[model samples]
Target: MNLARRALLEAGKLLVVLWLVSVLVFLALRLTPGDPAVLLLGPQAGRPDAAETLAQLRIEMGLDQPWIVQYGIWLGAMLTGDFGESARSGVSVTTLIVDALPPTLWLIALAVVISVPVSILAGTWAAYRGRGWFPNMVRFTSTMGVAIPAVWLGLVLIIVFAVNLSWFPSGGYVAPTEDPVGFLRHMVLPVATLSVFLSGILTRFVFAEATDVFRQDYMRTALAMGLPTRRRVFAYAARNAVLPMITIVGVQIGALIGGAVLVEAVFGLGGLGQLLLSSVLNRDYLVVQSAVLLTTVAVLLIGYVADIVYRLVDPRIAR
Candidate 1:
């Protein structure tokens, strides 16, 4: 009963936060410098006709309505899966998001797939052999990777793999229809760039957690029971250690999305990151709202799932 009540309370809190985010997103468009009308129109749009155009834009954009009324309309549209038309491209926001989602999913999915297993394995080994040179090397690499900004690291990879080595394309996105080989080639550097940094972050958390877990009383008991050392450490220790790592992973989902923007711009991948940049610059409210909302929802969803999984992994946690 307590656990169920707690879950319900958390869900309610999340909904409140979502509503607040909606209001903040709504207000951000009004608060930011420059008029969307002027941005869409021109610098010389101060004529009498320009005034008319601005009025029309205000109405079209729901800017003429009360703040609460406008928010209700936008929220209704969002609830109905209508994210509004893009001011820049005149396309459905959903179409843009759907088209852009695959690449980002591919990038994040591939990176996480590579990172989690590798990090877990390496972390386990390092915990088993903390004093070894290999563990020290892993520690140093993770430290350096965490310190270096992902954007800079992405540029370094581009220079080495694309510019200098001629192994991959440097700029521009290629659709699979255009050239599959060229498309994949363009993805390699950016995907790898995201993977490298994310891997570093995951590895650090895994190593730290695993090492601490190995010190527990139950872990010592498992070993004293004549179980194989690695088995005792991993099969038992991993469970306890993993709960804390779940939070780290949950938080990193947000960082990964944000990092994707920087990496995408640097690599010229036409993912949501690039779209987000264009939206912010042009004050495309719908696109901006969609981008930020999707990102927030994604991280929150990850956190929710992590909480559920953590409970399953250790039933005592729900107590």
Candidate 2:
């Protein structure tokens, strides 16, 4: 298939996945035990007219409507970019999400920037070493990196770096505009925590790819031709190995968004993960639904982009 046709097909898949996600998120929240109206009117529930107030509030919030009707109303509003207001704070869900999104984006962007090159270099070096102590150590470290919990890693970093050495702050976010140095300091541990996890995962894949590339006939020919060590390993071998790594990186980015929840919580960053968690706990249905749907859209789009890049890099993929 041509690029245009492939893109159109991928776009269709994205739409279908998003629709399914919307349905699942909507139903899942409603199926949960607590009633939003009751949660919203917690203290007032003991009043004599509490039942009457709850009934009125439910009607106003459209909770009295059938599931299909509620879904229809929400879908319609969503199409027009109206995510509705939060049940607890009465703030626009869109506004709340927009506010929380930047910190998470910064965390992900920084982690990617730091991790990708580091992983590629480490993996290529490991593969080049070819069964030495260094390669064995890299493999062992990657395994432990993948096995370690991000939350636990975050706490350990806090104790060693933040508490003991006083090199970085333990938690809380500061906007770069307010104080760039402080912002970097606050983010160092969280970013490092996320970067370590992602690097661990990416390095393994890179090592596998690079190892295969090194074994290729062309790579052997380059070595026989007395190609410079750097040029042979990087320009020839690493370049070929990195094409498949694009898709791997894209998938990791999506996973990174989810993983940020734990890292953000540990560090107290007011990111989307924290917002989604709080909304769910408070039974803020609209916020929860919108956050989940938005996150699904991001992940699906990232995967779609990765597929496109993969096809572009190796046109034979379209076959």
Candidate 3:
């Protein structure tokens, strides 16, 4: 298909996926045990008029409405950029999300900046070395890196670098505008923790792709021609190998948003992940639903961009 047609089809798929996600996010919370109305009126639940008050609150909050009606109301509000109020804090859900989004974005951006080059270099080096000890070691390390949990890694780094060494703070976030140096220092460990896992996966992927590129007939011909090592690798192998890595990297970056949630919680960054967790625990239905839907939108957009990048890398994909 042509690019326009492909894009249209992708857009349709995006809408379908988003609709499904909206339905699931709505139903899942409603099906859960706790009533948001009851949760909100905590101390008042013991009052003599508790039942009467709860019933009145439910009506006001639209909790007394049928599931379909509630879903329709929410979906309509969301389409117009109104995410409603938090059931717990009575704050606007959109405002809550907007406030929390930046720290998470910074974490993901920094992690990508640190991890990508390291992964590319390590992976390319391993591929170039073939079956040598270095390649074997890279493979082993990458495997372990992927298997390690982000939360555990964050804690270990904190104990070593933050506590014993006193090199970086244990947990917290500082906006770069307020204190550039302090912000960098605060982020180092969390960024490092996130980078390690991201690099591990990317390294393995690049190694596999570059290895296949190295084995291609053209690469063998370049070898026979005694082409300069840099030219052969960069001009021939890398160009081809990097094409596939683009899509994987894009998807991983999208996933990194979700993955950063655990790291953010561990490090106390007050990012969307932490907000979402708190909202879920507090039964802040609007906040939780909006957070999840926002995350889903981010992931889908990243994937769509990756598809576009594929067409840019190799125009054949658009066909």
User: Candidate 2, residues 1-319: lDDT per residue as tens digits?
Assistant: 7898979988998899899999999999999998899989998987888999999989988999999999999999999989999989989898999999989999999999998898889999899989989899889988888889999999999999999999999999999999999999999999999998898998999899999999999999999999999999899888888888888888887789889998999999999999998988998999999999988888888888998889888877767
| Best candidate according to lDDT | 2
Q: Measured by TM-score, how close is model 3 to the native structure?
A: 0.97
Collision count of model 3: 0
Write down the TM-score of every candidate.
0.90, 0.97, 0.97
What lDDT score is found at residue 295 in candidate 2?
89
- After superposing all C-alphas onto the true structure, candidate 1 shows an RMSD in angstroms of 2.4
Model 2's alpha-carbon lDDT is 0.91
lDDT of candidate 1 over 1-319, digit per residue (tens): 4667877887887788888887888788778998787787777577776888888988887778898897788889888888989887789998988888776776777677777777787777787687979999889887777788878988898889888999988877777678888878878888778877787888888889888888888777877789997677678766556667776777788888888888888988888888888889999888899878877777787887777667666678778
Model 2 CA deviation exceeding 4 Å by range: none
All models: lDDT?
0.81, 0.91, 0.89
lDDT value, residue 95 of candidate 2: 94
**Candidate 2 least-lDDT 10 residues:** 310-319
lDDT of 3 by residue, 1-319 (tens): 8887888899999999999999999999988998888889998887997999899989988999999999999999999999888878888888899999888999999998988888878888789889889999999989888999999999999999999999999988899999999999999998998888888999998899989989889889999999999888777776777787778878887668878889999999999999999888878888988899989998898888888878876977766
| Candidate 3 worst ten-residue window by lDDT | 233-242
Candidate with best TM-score: 2
Ranking by lDDT: 2, 3, 1
